[model samples]
Target: MAGRIVVGVDGSEPSLKALTWAAGQAALTGDALQTVIGWEYPASWAALMPGVPPEFDPERLAKQILDEAIDQALTPAQAAAVTRTVVGGNAPQALLDAAEGATLLVVGDRGRSGFTAAVLGSVSLHVTQHAPCPVVVVRGRTGA
Candidate 1:
Protein backbone atom coordinates (compact mmCIF):
# COMPACT_ATOMS: atom_id res chain seq x y z
CA MET A 1 0.00 0.00 0.00
CA ALA A 2 1.19 3.49 -0.73
CA GLY A 3 1.77 6.02 2.02
CA ARG A 4 -0.41 9.10 2.30
CA ILE A 5 0.61 12.76 2.65
CA VAL A 6 -2.04 15.04 4.10
CA VAL A 7 -1.87 18.78 3.59
CA GLY A 8 -4.12 21.57 4.83
CA VAL A 9 -5.23 24.26 2.36
CA ASP A 10 -7.18 27.41 3.19
CA GLY A 11 -6.73 29.28 -0.13
CA SER A 12 -4.32 31.74 1.45
CA GLU A 13 -1.05 32.54 -0.28
CA PRO A 14 0.88 30.56 2.30
CA SER A 15 -1.54 27.67 1.87
CA LEU A 16 -1.03 27.70 -1.89
CA LYS A 17 2.69 27.57 -1.32
CA ALA A 18 2.20 24.70 1.09
CA LEU A 19 0.06 22.86 -1.45
CA THR A 20 2.77 23.21 -4.06
CA TRP A 21 5.40 21.92 -1.66
CA ALA A 22 3.24 18.99 -0.62
CA ALA A 23 2.53 18.06 -4.23
CA GLY A 24 6.18 18.11 -5.11
CA GLN A 25 6.99 15.96 -2.12
CA ALA A 26 4.27 13.53 -3.06
CA ALA A 27 5.59 13.33 -6.59
CA LEU A 28 9.07 12.56 -5.33
CA THR A 29 7.97 9.98 -2.76
CA GLY A 30 5.05 8.46 -4.62
CA ASP A 31 2.72 9.07 -1.71
CA ALA A 32 -0.97 9.68 -2.16
CA LEU A 33 -1.52 13.42 -1.77
CA GLN A 34 -4.69 14.46 0.00
CA THR A 35 -5.61 18.15 0.36
CA VAL A 36 -7.82 18.91 3.34
CA ILE A 37 -9.86 22.08 3.91
CA GLY A 38 -12.36 23.01 6.58
CA TRP A 39 -15.10 25.56 7.11
CA GLU A 40 -17.25 26.63 10.04
CA TYR A 41 -19.88 29.18 10.82
CA PRO A 42 -18.34 32.21 12.47
CA ALA A 43 -19.01 32.57 16.18
CA SER A 44 -21.28 35.50 15.37
CA TRP A 45 -22.95 33.79 12.45
CA ALA A 46 -26.45 34.41 13.75
CA ALA A 47 -25.63 38.02 14.51
CA LEU A 48 -24.18 38.55 11.07
CA MET A 49 -26.98 36.87 9.20
CA PRO A 50 -30.41 36.76 10.77
CA GLY A 51 -31.42 34.23 8.13
CA VAL A 52 -29.24 32.00 6.04
CA PRO A 53 -28.87 33.20 2.49
CA PRO A 54 -30.24 30.89 -0.18
CA GLU A 55 -26.89 30.88 -1.94
CA PHE A 56 -24.77 30.58 1.18
CA ASP A 57 -23.01 27.27 1.52
CA PRO A 58 -19.86 26.99 3.55
CA GLU A 59 -19.13 23.42 2.45
CA ARG A 60 -19.30 24.28 -1.21
CA LEU A 61 -17.10 27.30 -0.65
CA ALA A 62 -14.56 25.11 1.13
CA LYS A 63 -14.45 22.72 -1.80
CA GLN A 64 -13.99 25.59 -4.25
CA ILE A 65 -11.18 27.02 -2.18
CA LEU A 66 -9.50 23.66 -2.10
CA ASP A 67 -9.85 23.25 -5.84
CA GLU A 68 -8.60 26.74 -6.58
CA ALA A 69 -5.60 26.24 -4.35
CA ILE A 70 -4.76 23.04 -6.19
CA ASP A 71 -5.17 24.73 -9.54
CA GLN A 72 -2.97 27.64 -8.46
CA ALA A 73 -0.27 25.38 -7.08
CA LEU A 74 -0.07 22.26 -9.24
CA THR A 75 0.06 21.17 -12.84
CA PRO A 76 -3.02 19.58 -14.44
CA ALA A 77 -1.75 16.06 -13.84
CA GLN A 78 -0.74 16.85 -10.27
CA ALA A 79 -4.07 18.49 -9.54
CA ALA A 80 -5.91 15.52 -11.04
CA ALA A 81 -4.00 13.13 -8.79
CA VAL A 82 -4.88 15.04 -5.62
CA THR A 83 -7.64 13.89 -3.28
CA ARG A 84 -9.74 16.85 -2.15
CA THR A 85 -11.31 16.59 1.29
CA VAL A 86 -13.69 19.18 2.71
CA VAL A 87 -14.59 18.98 6.37
CA GLY A 88 -16.79 20.90 8.80
CA GLY A 89 -15.10 22.82 11.65
CA ASN A 90 -11.70 24.51 11.91
CA ALA A 91 -8.51 23.81 10.01
CA PRO A 92 -6.27 22.42 12.76
CA GLN A 93 -8.74 19.79 13.90
CA ALA A 94 -9.63 18.85 10.32
CA LEU A 95 -5.97 18.37 9.51
CA LEU A 96 -5.31 16.30 12.62
CA ASP A 97 -8.31 14.09 12.01
CA ALA A 98 -7.41 13.56 8.35
CA ALA A 99 -3.80 12.82 9.28
CA GLU A 100 -4.66 9.61 11.07
CA GLY A 101 -2.48 6.84 9.65
CA ALA A 102 -0.92 9.32 7.28
CA THR A 103 2.76 9.00 6.51
CA LEU A 104 3.17 12.76 6.80
CA LEU A 105 1.26 15.95 7.43
CA VAL A 106 2.10 19.31 5.88
CA VAL A 107 0.87 22.86 6.55
CA GLY A 108 1.68 26.48 5.79
CA ASP A 109 2.82 29.08 8.30
CA ARG A 110 -0.24 31.27 7.68
CA GLY A 111 1.99 34.27 6.90
CA ARG A 112 1.92 36.06 10.18
CA SER A 113 3.88 39.28 10.75
CA GLY A 114 6.17 40.86 13.34
CA PHE A 115 7.07 38.66 16.31
CA THR A 116 4.36 36.23 15.34
CA ALA A 117 5.82 35.87 11.87
CA ALA A 118 9.02 34.46 13.32
CA VAL A 119 6.94 31.72 14.91
CA LEU A 120 4.47 29.30 13.49
CA GLY A 121 0.93 30.52 13.01
CA SER A 122 -1.70 29.21 15.42
CA VAL A 123 -2.96 26.44 13.12
CA SER A 124 0.52 25.42 12.14
CA LEU A 125 1.65 25.48 15.73
CA HIS A 126 -1.29 23.40 16.89
CA VAL A 127 -0.91 20.79 14.19
CA THR A 128 2.84 20.54 14.66
CA GLN A 129 2.33 19.82 18.32
CA HIS A 130 -0.59 17.42 17.93
CA ALA A 131 -0.58 15.82 14.51
CA PRO A 132 -0.91 12.02 14.43
CA CYS A 133 2.00 11.75 12.04
CA PRO A 134 5.25 13.51 11.26
CA VAL A 135 4.43 17.12 10.37
CA VAL A 136 6.23 19.44 8.02
CA VAL A 137 5.52 23.18 8.34
CA VAL A 138 6.20 24.93 5.07
CA ARG A 139 7.83 28.26 5.93
CA GLY A 140 8.52 31.16 3.59
CA ARG A 141 7.24 34.54 2.49
CA THR A 142 3.84 34.57 0.88
CA GLY A 143 3.54 35.36 -2.88
CA ALA A 144 7.20 34.54 -3.33
Candidate 2:
Protein backbone atom coordinates (compact mmCIF):
# COMPACT_ATOMS: atom_id res chain seq x y z
CA MET A 1 0.00 0.00 0.00
CA ALA A 2 1.26 3.48 -0.81
CA GLY A 3 -0.48 5.06 2.16
CA ARG A 4 -2.46 4.34 5.28
CA ILE A 5 -5.48 2.03 5.17
CA VAL A 6 -8.46 3.69 6.80
CA VAL A 7 -11.35 1.74 8.25
CA GLY A 8 -14.63 3.10 9.60
CA VAL A 9 -15.87 1.57 12.82
CA ASP A 10 -19.19 2.13 14.55
CA GLY A 11 -19.18 -0.40 17.37
CA SER A 12 -21.31 -2.78 15.36
CA GLU A 13 -20.60 -6.36 14.36
CA PRO A 14 -20.16 -5.51 10.71
CA SER A 15 -17.91 -2.60 11.56
CA LEU A 16 -15.82 -4.92 13.68
CA LYS A 17 -15.52 -7.23 10.69
CA ALA A 18 -14.36 -4.31 8.59
CA LEU A 19 -11.75 -3.44 11.19
CA THR A 20 -10.47 -6.97 11.22
CA TRP A 21 -10.26 -7.14 7.45
CA ALA A 22 -8.50 -3.79 7.30
CA ALA A 23 -5.96 -4.84 9.88
CA GLY A 24 -5.09 -7.96 7.93
CA GLN A 25 -4.79 -6.01 4.69
CA ALA A 26 -2.53 -3.45 6.35
CA ALA A 27 -0.33 -6.17 7.78
CA LEU A 28 -0.02 -7.91 4.43
CA THR A 29 0.70 -4.69 2.58
CA GLY A 30 3.06 -3.33 5.20
CA ASP A 31 0.96 -0.20 5.54
CA ALA A 32 -0.31 1.56 8.61
CA LEU A 33 -3.91 0.91 9.58
CA GLN A 34 -6.15 3.65 10.85
CA THR A 35 -9.44 2.86 12.54
CA VAL A 36 -11.81 5.81 12.55
CA ILE A 37 -14.94 6.09 14.62
CA GLY A 38 -17.30 8.91 13.81
CA TRP A 39 -19.86 10.39 16.13
CA GLU A 40 -22.17 13.37 16.52
CA TYR A 41 -23.96 14.56 19.58
CA PRO A 42 -27.67 14.92 19.66
CA ALA A 43 -29.05 18.42 19.55
CA SER A 44 -29.14 20.44 22.78
CA TRP A 45 -32.89 20.19 22.83
CA ALA A 46 -32.72 16.43 22.60
CA ALA A 47 -30.29 16.30 25.47
CA LEU A 48 -32.65 18.41 27.52
CA MET A 49 -35.20 15.61 27.51
CA PRO A 50 -36.13 14.08 30.84
CA GLY A 51 -33.42 11.98 32.54
CA VAL A 52 -30.85 12.85 29.88
CA PRO A 53 -27.55 14.17 31.16
CA PRO A 54 -26.53 17.57 29.92
CA GLU A 55 -22.80 16.93 30.17
CA PHE A 56 -22.69 14.13 27.64
CA ASP A 57 -19.96 14.54 25.02
CA PRO A 58 -20.35 12.74 21.74
CA GLU A 59 -16.70 13.05 20.80
CA ARG A 60 -15.64 11.43 24.03
CA LEU A 61 -18.10 8.62 23.47
CA ALA A 62 -16.79 8.15 19.97
CA LYS A 63 -13.23 7.87 21.21
CA GLN A 64 -14.22 5.38 23.85
CA ILE A 65 -16.11 3.30 21.34
CA LEU A 66 -13.20 3.40 18.91
CA ASP A 67 -10.77 2.29 21.59
CA GLU A 68 -12.98 -0.60 22.56
CA ALA A 69 -13.57 -1.61 18.97
CA ILE A 70 -9.87 -1.51 18.22
CA ASP A 71 -9.19 -3.69 21.22
CA GLN A 72 -11.71 -6.23 19.97
CA ALA A 73 -10.72 -6.07 16.33
CA LEU A 74 -6.95 -6.30 16.48
CA THR A 75 -4.79 -9.16 17.58
CA PRO A 76 -1.78 -8.73 19.88
CA ALA A 77 0.47 -8.71 16.85
CA GLN A 78 -1.60 -5.95 15.19
CA ALA A 79 -1.61 -3.66 18.19
CA ALA A 80 0.68 -1.18 16.52
CA ALA A 81 -2.02 0.06 14.18
CA VAL A 82 -2.84 3.75 14.45
CA THR A 83 -6.39 4.63 15.49
CA ARG A 84 -8.40 7.83 15.41
CA THR A 85 -11.87 9.06 16.30
CA VAL A 86 -13.59 11.84 14.39
CA VAL A 87 -16.48 14.04 15.45
CA GLY A 88 -18.47 15.10 12.47
CA GLY A 89 -22.02 15.90 11.44
CA ASN A 90 -22.37 12.34 10.19
CA ALA A 91 -20.51 9.08 9.70
CA PRO A 92 -20.28 9.35 5.93
CA GLN A 93 -18.76 12.82 6.06
CA ALA A 94 -16.19 11.84 8.64
CA LEU A 95 -15.21 8.74 6.71
CA LEU A 96 -15.00 10.63 3.44
CA ASP A 97 -12.86 13.30 5.02
CA ALA A 98 -10.49 10.68 6.39
CA ALA A 99 -10.27 8.96 3.00
CA GLU A 100 -8.65 11.96 1.35
CA GLY A 101 -5.11 10.59 1.38
CA ALA A 102 -5.74 6.98 2.26
CA THR A 103 -4.69 4.10 0.07
CA LEU A 104 -8.00 2.42 0.72
CA LEU A 105 -11.05 2.94 2.89
CA VAL A 106 -12.80 -0.03 4.41
CA VAL A 107 -16.30 -0.17 5.83
CA GLY A 108 -18.99 -2.65 6.73
CA ASP A 109 -21.95 -3.73 4.65
CA ARG A 110 -24.49 -3.25 7.43
CA GLY A 111 -24.20 -1.96 10.95
CA ARG A 112 -26.46 -2.19 14.00
CA SER A 113 -29.48 -3.20 11.89
CA GLY A 114 -30.79 -3.93 8.44
CA PHE A 115 -28.57 -6.90 7.78
CA THR A 116 -31.28 -9.09 6.30
CA ALA A 117 -29.41 -9.00 3.02
CA ALA A 118 -26.06 -7.96 1.55
CA VAL A 119 -27.06 -4.34 1.16
CA LEU A 120 -24.64 -1.68 2.31
CA GLY A 121 -25.38 0.75 5.08
CA SER A 122 -26.30 4.31 4.14
CA VAL A 123 -22.96 5.62 5.29
CA SER A 124 -21.06 2.96 3.41
CA LEU A 125 -23.04 3.63 0.27
CA HIS A 126 -22.34 7.32 0.54
CA VAL A 127 -18.66 6.73 1.09
CA THR A 128 -18.52 4.36 -1.88
CA GLN A 129 -20.01 7.06 -4.04
CA HIS A 130 -17.85 9.92 -2.77
CA ALA A 131 -14.68 8.63 -1.16
CA PRO A 132 -11.48 10.03 -2.65
CA CYS A 133 -9.80 6.66 -2.47
CA PRO A 134 -10.91 3.10 -3.14
CA VAL A 135 -13.60 1.78 -0.84
CA VAL A 136 -14.06 -1.75 0.39
CA VAL A 137 -17.25 -2.98 2.03
CA VAL A 138 -16.47 -5.98 4.15
CA ARG A 139 -19.15 -8.50 4.94
CA GLY A 140 -18.85 -11.49 7.21
CA ARG A 141 -16.21 -14.08 6.41
CA THR A 142 -18.90 -16.67 5.68
CA GLY A 143 -20.58 -14.24 3.30
CA ALA A 144 -23.60 -13.87 5.50
Q: lDDT at 138 for candidate 2?
A: 88
Residues 5-83, candidate 1: write the lDDT tens digits. 9998988777888888989899899999999998889899989889788789999988988888899899999999999
**Cα deviation of 97 in candidate 2 (Å)?**
0.5
User: 1-144 in candidate 2: lDDT tens per residue?
Assistant: 257998998888889999989988987888788877777655775656666676877778778888888888888668554767566667889888888899999999876654566467788888999999999998744543
Q: Rate the local accuracy (lDDT) of all candidates.
A: 0.87, 0.81
| Poorest 10 consecutive residues by lDDT, candidate 2 | 110-119
TM-score of 2: 0.86
| Regions more than 4 Å wrong, model 1 | 49-52, 111-118, 142-144
Q: What global local distance difference test value does model 1 have?
A: 0.87
User: Which ranges in model 2 have alpha carbons more than 4 Å from their true place?
Assistant: 43-49, 113-118, 141-144
lDDT (Cα, 0-100) at 37 in candidate 1: 92
Candidate 1 residue 95 Cα shift, in angstroms, is 0.4
Candidate 1, residue 101: CA error in Å? 0.3
Error of 2 at 134 (Å): 0.8
